[model samples]
Target: MAGKQVMLVGVDDSERSFYALQWTLDHFFHSPSASPFKLVVVHAKSIPISAISLGGPGAVDILSLVEKDLKSTAERVTEKTKEACKKKGVEVEVDVTEGDARNVMCDAVEKHHASVLVLGSHGYGVFKRAVLGSVSDYCSHHAHCSVMIVKKPMAKN
Candidate 1:
């Protein structure tokens, strides 16, 4: 365990995130003479407060439905990611925490004592990027360890 490094990778249902995980596995975990490491897959799920608050008398029902949906989605995505890693013969720890994506990922890195954190950029335009903010960008600066943001390749047409 002395030389084992912990690698934290943020994953979701997005193609970009899946690609990032694949990239990490191919580039690092599958490399010859690669250092010993544990892959920690982190997925953040925020409560659907906005959806609940918008409804009037049916807020409770809306909250329940939204919560269920989000949980199922998160679980499905994490399972899929885990299965893919297993197929590659790489073991990973899956973390699904409820909080802001940026904060949750950063906290995961520190809590797990990861030496490196990897993410995938969504390639959002300026307007959307400014409006929604960038989780990867925020994590890159705020994470306790080194950060890697994998950019998705352009589609060849």
Candidate 2:
């Protein structure tokens, strides 16, 4: 246990994130002996900036509701993650934090001293990627650890 290097994976409510987690489990943890690395999964829950910025009537009320929704979503995401790990009979540590995903993920890598950070690729085009701000792209460059982006195979019609 002490000798294993840490492997951190960033996840969200997206299908792509789940796909990445599953892919990692299938490929890396399939060995007969104990898996090579200790696994940790992080879910970044976005703060409701819009509610705070509104500063209008009922803004505080809306903020509470938004926070509730965020908490609920986090619970759901973590539950699914647990189930995914259970499938591989792998023990996983799950964390939920409030912030932008990119920052949260990088912070996790630093905190865990992870050897590698895994993420899902949305495969956004250049334009969309630029506009949406790709989390995987940011982490790959900024994270202290190596990054593995798992891209799900596109379904054919």
Per-model TM-score on C-alpha atoms: 0.92, 0.96
Q: Give the Cα error of residue 10 in candidate 1, in Å.
A: 0.3
State the lDDT of candidate 2 residue by residue for 2-83, as single tens digits: 7899989899999999999999999888861578799999999999998899877999999999999999999999999999
Local distance difference test scores for all models: 0.88, 0.93
Give, for candidate 1, the lowest lDDT window spanning 10 residues: 28-37
Q: Where does candidate 2 have its weakest 10-residue lDDT segment?
A: 27-36
Give the residue spans of candidate 1 off by over 4 A: 1-3, 31-34
lDDT of 1: 0.88
Q: What's the residue-level lDDT of 145 in candidate 2?
A: 88
The per-residue C-alpha lDDT of model 2 at residue 110 equals: 87
Q: Which candidate is the best by lDDT?
A: 2
